[model samples]
Target: MTSTTTTGQERKAPGRPRNAQADEAILDAVLTLMAEGQSAAAVSIESVAAKAGVGKATIYRRWPNKEALLIDAVRSMKGPIPELAGVSARADLIAMVTANRSSRVQEFGKVTACLLPELMKDEQLRQMHHAVMEPRREVMREILRRGIASGELRADLNIELTLLMLSGPSMAQGLFGTETGVPLEEFPVVLVDALLRGAAA
Candidate 1:
């Protein structure tokens, strides 16, 4: 069902400038379909074009191919940079890892662990992932920066490498993360305790 009118507040009201709604619809359809575990490659632009009710040009105008499109969809679904305003950096960091559903993390993990290697060979795909992941990664970096500044964390810490170390265990649980046999509620606490102890002032 395609509508001619836009759907937002007065200023932003004309939500989709140019069939933007259709583009959004296309992305939404792709996510809904991909969630069923379909390989991103097996999905076709024609299908998305049809689903979004826009011409194929519309999709390509925004994304060159399925991978780019999928990455965009993933970025759209990205949750707010997990943070606890005004809390201790330690508490904020713990909330960052714990507040969200690990299942979402695992789903992303499976895609990254499996698809990334294959995509790595393609420069376009690599850049696409960077474009998608960079903003979110910056959020974590900022969190660490705040911790370092406030003396809750050691300044000598390698924020970049530290990110991997901090996120490693949570991600290492593999494909289904929780299926790694760790309990749901315990993940953030265990990860926080370990990471904090290592980085503590």
Candidate 2:
């Protein structure tokens, strides 16, 4: 039998549910600032609260600190992990690079670059950063392993070094100026072709 109050009305849960709309608004504010090219140093709880139309205490109740908030925002900003479909390693690599170069990822990279010094000093932030990147690294590692197994890559190739080689040019484009000799969109093809031809058994 269903339980009821002494007055014969149905009883309710103890507390009100958290407002989903408010949560979405707060997260959206953070993303909006990033999209607007606001540096991590420039993002503050007060600014986010004002943009989100919520009190500063509301944000604190949800996130312990600004670093935690940024971690959550950046995690959501990533591109989809590249799928390896037994296609040619070179093709899959190109797909991965293309996905990583999406606008969101580039924006997040800029945010991260702005916060790099703080992230290096803070243990918790460093852990969060590693957690965000681990899956992408594993996917790249798997693709390289598949290439090795298929004899498409050299048997003695160091997967770690190869990952760096594949990604370095694009990363360099971001770190250095965009004038990387080759245009940004052409980087994946050029780097992948060079690696495959040189590294092929």
Candidate 3:
């Protein structure tokens, strides 16, 4: 008899294939609810189950609680980190920034805007958010490190501060609707170029 196996905090019955369609439906339901302007508190497992057309047991089987489900939904919206070119930091950074702006910005912005207030009040949610974001941040950190090593960026470039500088504007625009008088499609190139002016060696 095949036993269960632990993967991270989740356990899976051996040889039991996950239903990708159900997972997508559940995650998409969460996004839909948030996009429809529901606050995090307003979204419950029951509502998500109804929207997703899956039983509440299905969600419970995957996530221990509503908060865990919400975090996973947000992670799904973030999608995957863009594959870097590894040619130069500038080009790679541009690709990273551009991918963020172009793909999931609107949906992610909606979810984050809806969830931000609750995220601030809940320690667990904040930790979950950080865990989800750290990998992307680490990618940026490595790019900045490589830039320094290759002499492509300033020798004294502060990686942490520079990471904030690179990510802040786009996030600000996404969350707060900050208008920069630049077309959204063009903003990534403009933003990266301007930052590099001061950051490049």
Candidate 4:
């Protein structure tokens, strides 16, 4: 005699089919909430699932947890790293830093800062943050390396340290400098000029 599997007990498919539109919708929903300064406490799977117009199951099928979903949303804020060639190192660095300070990136950074305490306590969240940030860091290293090679920057300039110097202020501002997200009008200009001066060969 054949046995029957009860409801919610049947062997599920290995996985549900991928849905591109649904994925985009979910990410957009997360960004929308973050840009509005919604607290992490308010952003749960149930809420995002509803905002995305997909079931909670769909979200779980992809992310398995809230942190993973949030990480992906932050990573998606950076569409593609722009080409860093075809310009002077100073010009390139300025463009790169300014481009990253765009409205969407700033919004994502602010949300990340807001969630920093919790993220720091969790290994998985820290790993995801590194994974998202490492590529961008590498790109800046390449630019700095080029600057050194071209005699624009000091030959002994430490790439990693310089990257930290350039990016740290904006990140701090997002985290603690302002509540309304101050405009980076002269921030990039002032920061870049100071960095180049210190590193100039």
TM-score to native of every candidate shown: 0.63, 0.70, 0.78, 0.70
Candidate 3's TM-score: 0.78
Clashes of each: 0, 0, 0, 0
Ordering by TM-score: 3, 4, 2, 1
* lDDT of candidate 2 over 111-194, digit per residue (tens): 545555666688977776676667677778888898889988889989999888876766666655577577667877888888
Residue pair clashes in candidate 4: none
lDDT of each: 0.62, 0.70, 0.75, 0.70
58-111: candidate 3 lDDT, tens digit per residue: 888877888877777666655357888899998888877776554556556757
Candidate 2's C-alpha runs over 4 A off are 1-42, 51-62, 180-186, 198-201
Q: Enumerate residue pairs that collide in model 2.
A: none
Candidate 1 Cα errors over 4 Å, as ranges: 1-39, 46-64, 83-86, 98-103, 176-182, 198-201
Winner on TM-score between 1 and 4 is: 4
Best by TM-score: 3
User: What local lDDT score does residue 19 receive in model 1, on the 0 to 100 scale?
Assistant: 59
- The C-alpha local distance difference test score for the whole of candidate 3 amounts to 0.75
lDDT of 4 by residue, 127-166 (tens): 7677666767777888888888888889999888899898
